[model samples]
Target: MKVFDKYILKSFLEPFLATFFVVLFVLVMQSLWLAFDEIAGKGIDIFFILKFLVYLALMLTPTALPIGILLSSIMALGNLSENYEMAAIKSAGISLKRVIRPLIFLILFISALNFVFLNNIYPWATLKQKNLYLNMKKKKPALALVPGAFNTDIPGYSIKFEEKYGEEDNLLKNVQIADLSQSKGKIKVITAQKGIISTEEGSKYMTLTLENGNYYEEHINKSMQPKDRAKMPASKATFKTYTINIDISSFNDDDKLDDEKIKEHHGMLSIVQLDSISKVNKIKYDEYTKNQADYFFNILEAKKLYKYPDSLIDTKLDSVILNNFTTYNKSIVLNESIQLLKRTIDHNKNQKISFKDKRKLLNLYDHEIYYRISFSLACLVLFFIGAPLGSIIRKGGFGLPMIMAIIIFVIYFFISKLGGNLSEESAISALFGSWLSTLILLPFGILLTRRATQGMGIFNIDSVLDNIQKLFNKTGNKTTNL
Candidate 1:
């Protein structure tokens, strides 16, 4: 290697390593903070917490790499320019492009590494982190319950409460429970005016104490006729105070938690998996759309409605088809037609909601496929932007370069999030949404590189001012002549 190439590589590497770890640490901490509620006071082991952090860091490494490259490139080049080393190299006939050539190759290699992380390591980490979190929640299922939503962390039970408040957050208001433990599709529902929850450490049971409640159990009898099903026997009991002990042995069993159960989430899939699933989903989606269209067509009976007999081909028909019927029959037919139309409209409305949900799911898969590719190239894209920007600004150290990096990265992140949201809603194509930020910044990077190489300022403020003055002068002259 040439001495200059080695020197430049060495300079870039120092800040790159420093910034990469710094960014990774910040991201991991941010994730931990967001999940603090789920982990705090849950009696989870310290080692388990550490393992979660490790998985989180692995999952976020690809995101941190690009930011590190951007900041390091800016600081490295900015330092060289600020210290007059860039000028000395230029005086020695070394072009700006040649100075950055080694860094360019390094960034390309980093980009490929980022791709590997995103395609392989990221999915693995996501799967581990998700399952590990679920296991943690299972360990203390009561603490994981949030008011106003059904909590199914407990097996065979769906629990919800209107409010959870008290010194230890163990008090519940308007508690509702759905028991699904029976083998023969039997259902039991319990509602309480107020309830208290208590669990002991290392215990296999959690007790719920209800103050004022009612229990309703439905008796299932498949042998009964359909007409009698609605009137099937049921049992209801009211109590001033009731206590129930729930067996939580399954929650303590880590061996029962299967990691394979959660591999279908978009974050847990690789590029190949995403592509394959997307293709299958697209086929199913198309088939579903076609089937719906066919079903509605059949319901409308359009073919029958438009059909005419050969004898009636040349005859003038009444404007209303019911005109040939007697008054009583016409009214009856009109009422039936109105009722059918109402049912069709209601069915269409329901189908529309289902279609929208399926479309959004497919959009998520499509976005992930393109996002992996685009995000992997961020290192290269950001290097071009940051390196030239550093040369043009001619500032070194963390003050100005750090601020600039933050501003640029914030803009990029905002655009990416916005595009993803729009794409998910089907307002924009997934390909366009995934690449929007990169496309917006690429030209700016090229412009900065051009100006830096040509020894010009970031923008020609003097020329813009001159044009404004010239426009004013022309306007003044025209007014005077009038």
Candidate 2:
């Protein structure tokens, strides 16, 4: 019995790992094949290109593992059954449940691994992949153009060449530029007979060695009645051997603003940071509320005091009271207006402060940070579902399993993405969006696992079809309605 348990466990472990690698390979190979041209044209290094792909595979693993595990498990068990290994065990008086103890443990251990990757490692991979992609674009932007292809990089700047030379090293032949500088209002086409790209220390500049070229430009040029600038005249320029320097610094990836840095800015924020922001928000809200209360109370008190009549008062003593009352009332009015203004201004400031209308903005940041983590963790969910699905599928080969895996993965991917959008739009809570995929698949996983382990029929497709036929049956009982 001990030997049998060890043998089956070893079998599962060996093939599960094998299947996992195979699936991971297929997904990544497909991606690389699709993106190969882009990578090569961009002058991307073999090492970095492979590294980028590795992280991509890591990001994808959680999605692939479960299906591999499922199909492999089914094949492993079915083969054993066909060979009468189960019968041999039954004759030895071992119950089916006891035989599966090792598998159960295996499931628990895999689940734990899934959780760790999802929570930590997976998020790190996501961050790295994004950063790497940004860097890759920066390092080799010339990849965007193919030789003799029209390239549009800079806005209002378009270029075409007869040929490209030597691995983004340089270019040769006819070059054309559309100069809208004079007719900046309208496009002016400028064609040059020749041009050369030159590197200037820290920057890349395209220097045009123009032999003969014509520049067309148009614009409103003149000090005009400020309102009549619309009626201004147009202008154009044609030059030979002219030099124009584009601030391609912005075009370079290095100098461009990074969106990831902004997102992860507060992502690494400590609990202390969160608390501080929350505390500041609380203080502003409280101050606004207090000022509002004071304004209303001042109005109430002013009305009450002013309503006291002159006829009810003694002249000598009441005159002092009356004078003091008038002064105080004016002071109160002034104070109220100032406070109201302060509150209004503060409200406007806070309106844009992002704590009011965007109560979920901070929460959204939190959500975004956790999105990759949840996906990584999805590896575990998929595993549970995949393993059981394979057992029930009972097809002992890769074809059926691969198709089923794709279908399940597609459903999982679509729903989760939809949920993520809903949460970001604040249509649904962030936590809910992140967890919705897990919640949806968990029950199906459990159900499938139990059915597979217990040897239950997977579906009632035949019965369901039969029911459809019966619903439209022409044959009917002739007995009177009872």
Candidate 3:
């Protein structure tokens, strides 16, 4: 039994590693394609790019793990069944249950490890990836420019050039720079016949040296006046040689946001941190709700000022007494009531918005608490599904198993995403929504396992239909006899 368990474990491990890396690689490539526009052409260091990929891979582990498990389990079980090894073992007095026992223990262990990863490693990777992307966005855009296009990435400036030459690509011809740094209504245009763009070593500045250029400046009047009366300021100058320096310190790769600050987000909080923060937030939420309720109640009470006689007035007033009030007093009361009604409506709107925002914040924290546990347990649930499904289907190899795994996992992922959105919006309890995917798949897994144990095929639709037809025939014969 020990030897058999070792053999089975080895088979599972080989496929698990292969599938894990493949899935992770695919996900990372997809993410990189989407981010290529922003990260590429920026002259970023190769080390930085590699670091980003590593962090991204770490962040995607939770997503990749379940798929990897599902596919690998299917392949392992399918291979055993396809080769008739499972039947051979069962023929020798070994039950299918015993054969699967070792694998089940391994899956449970993986699930627990997934839990720890979710709590610790996942959050750290999420924080790093988020900060890295933000830092890249903050990088100066001048470094991302392409030839022949108007690059407006830089604030208050638009740069364009006709051609770029030389091994270092420092040489430029027909350069045009528009400087609108001063005001919206003013612009300074500089045109150069030929130029060279370069950055000083160990400096935070970039310089453009032009051999021959013409500078034109224009200022539009800010006053509201007739077009003829609006004064326009214009200036022009010609230079044999000129140089312009721009502060490019923002492009420095060393500048990074503090890790602690980035980790303050809810997604970047560990289980322990989330628990502590959720408790504090819950207390604050309760207090705010109670205080707001009381405040609004006070407002409702104060609204009674619009009514005459106040406490002295009976709930059921006589028509004569009510009609006894003067028209002037009635008009004054109506005006005040309208004004108070408007204020109440506005206050209610703001209160509703405030409460919803607070609830969403609390829900997010609550959701993560359950999200960690659900994703951890998803490993076991998916394995139960894949292993039995593989046995029932009686197919092995990457081809069929990969397809089935993707289809099943996609359904699970979509359901989880839907539940997450619902839970985040407080439409459903966090526990129910977070566990929804697992709950839905659990019964299917049991059914598949039962069928496999009973030596039944995965699908018997024809058998079900035949039984239904026989039942109908028997009912018809009974009616005829009656």
Candidate 4:
């Protein structure tokens, strides 16, 4: 390798490694903070927590890589330019392109590595992280319950509360519980003004004590008469104190922690898996839509209506046809038609919702495939942008370069998120949404590179002013001649 190439490589590598780890650490810590509630007080082992962090860092590597590249590229080139090394190289007939050639190849390799992480390591880490987090939550189910939302992490109960406050965070206020253990022909509900949760060490049961509560139960029997069922046989009672022991043995099983039962999320799929699943789902969706259309058509007897001759289907023929039928027959026919129309309307409404949900799911899969490709290329794209902007700005270190890198990255991040959201809603095609940020930034990068190479500022303000002055001069001359 040439001495200059080695120098450039060393300069870029130092900042790249420093910035990459810094960005990765920040991202991992941010994720950990967001999930602190789920992890804290769950009795998770320290080693288990470390493993989760490793998985989290692995999962977030692709995300942090591009930002790291952008910031470091800016800083590296900015330092060279600020130190007059860029000018010296330019004076010595070394073009900006030649100076960054080694770095360009390096960035390309990093982009490929980023793709590998996105395509393989990301999915594995996502699966492991999700399963581990689920197991942690299940380890102590009481800690999983958050106020104001239905908590179904427990086996046979749905618990909700307006408030949970106490030194141990076990006391609840305005608690409601739905006992789904009796899944056969019986329903029980309990509501309380206050409640307390207690779990003993090495015990299989958690005791819930409710104060000033109402208990309601509804019973249904297959042998009961229609009239008896219509009456809705039920029981109700009020109690100052009520106690229920919930069996939590199933959730306390440590062996299940390593089990990978939940692996269907799009994030947990590779590009090949996503493409295969998306194709299959699209075919199923099309078939479902076609079947629904055919079913509704048959239910509405549309074929029979269309089978009549055009002459007999006219508005005048409608009156004649009704006149031929007796009034009683006419009323029965009209009532049946109205009911069918109502049924068709209701069916269409439901089908619309079903189709929307299916399409959204397909969009998610499609977006993931395209997003992986686009995100991997972001290292290359952002490098072009950051390196050029750094050269033009002619500043080094974490001062101006850091600010510029952050602003550019923020814009890129916002566009990516917005595009993904729109894609998920079916407002835009997944392919377009996934590449939207790249498409938007590529031109800016090109423009910056061109300007920096030509020794021009980001905007040619002097040229604009000169053009305006010339225009004014022409206009004044024309006015004087007139």
User: lDDT (CA) for every model shown?
Assistant: 0.89, 0.63, 0.85, 0.90
For model 3, the stretches where C-alpha displacement exceeds 4 angstroms are: 142-169, 174-181, 184-192, 212-238, 257-261, 302-316, 460-463
Q: Which lDDT tens digits does candidate 4 get at residues 1-482? A: 99999999998889889989998999999999998897687556677889899999999999899988999999998899999999999999999889889999999999999999999999999999999888877676434788999988787799999998999999999999998886644378999999999999989899999999999987876577768876877899999999999887765676667778899899999999999999999999999989997998789778797677677446355576667889899899899999988988998898899889998999999999999999999999999999988898888787887788889999999999999999999999999999999999999999998888887878899999999999999999999999
Alpha-carbon error at 129 in model 2, in Å?
2.2
Task: Please report, as a residue range, the 10-residue window in candidate 1 with the lowest summed lDDT.
Answer: 251-260
Q: What is the lDDT of residue 142 in candidate 3?
A: 40
Model 1 accuracy (lDDT, Cα): 0.89
Ranked candidates (TM-score, high to low): 3, 4, 1, 2
Candidate 1 residue spans exceeding 4 A from truth = 141-260, 308-327
Cα lDDT of model 2 by residue, 1-482, tens digit:
47877897986777778888988898888877776655455545566777778888987676566656665666565555556766576677875556657876776676667656655556667676667666665554542444576666654566676765556546556667665444333345667666656557766554545546667654444444557755656455666666667555544544332235423433333334444665565567678667756765675566686667666464444565556667779799899899977876775576555534454554455455455457655655676676556545555455666677678878888888888778867788877887888789888877876776676657868888998888656344333332
Clashing pairs in 3: none
Q: Using TM-score, give the best candidate's number.
A: 3
Tens digit of lDDT per residue, candidate 3, span 371-434?
Answer: 8899999999999899888888778899999999999999999999888889989899988889
Better of 3 and 4 by TM-score: 3
**Clashes per model (N, Cα, C within 3 A):** 0, 5, 0, 0
Q: What's the TM-score of every candidate structure?
A: 0.76, 0.56, 0.87, 0.76
Off by over 4 Å in 2: 26-48, 82-84, 87-91, 135-260, 263-393, 410-454, 459-482
**What is model 4's C-alpha RMSD?**
8.4
Ranked by TM-score, the better of candidates 2 and 4 is 4
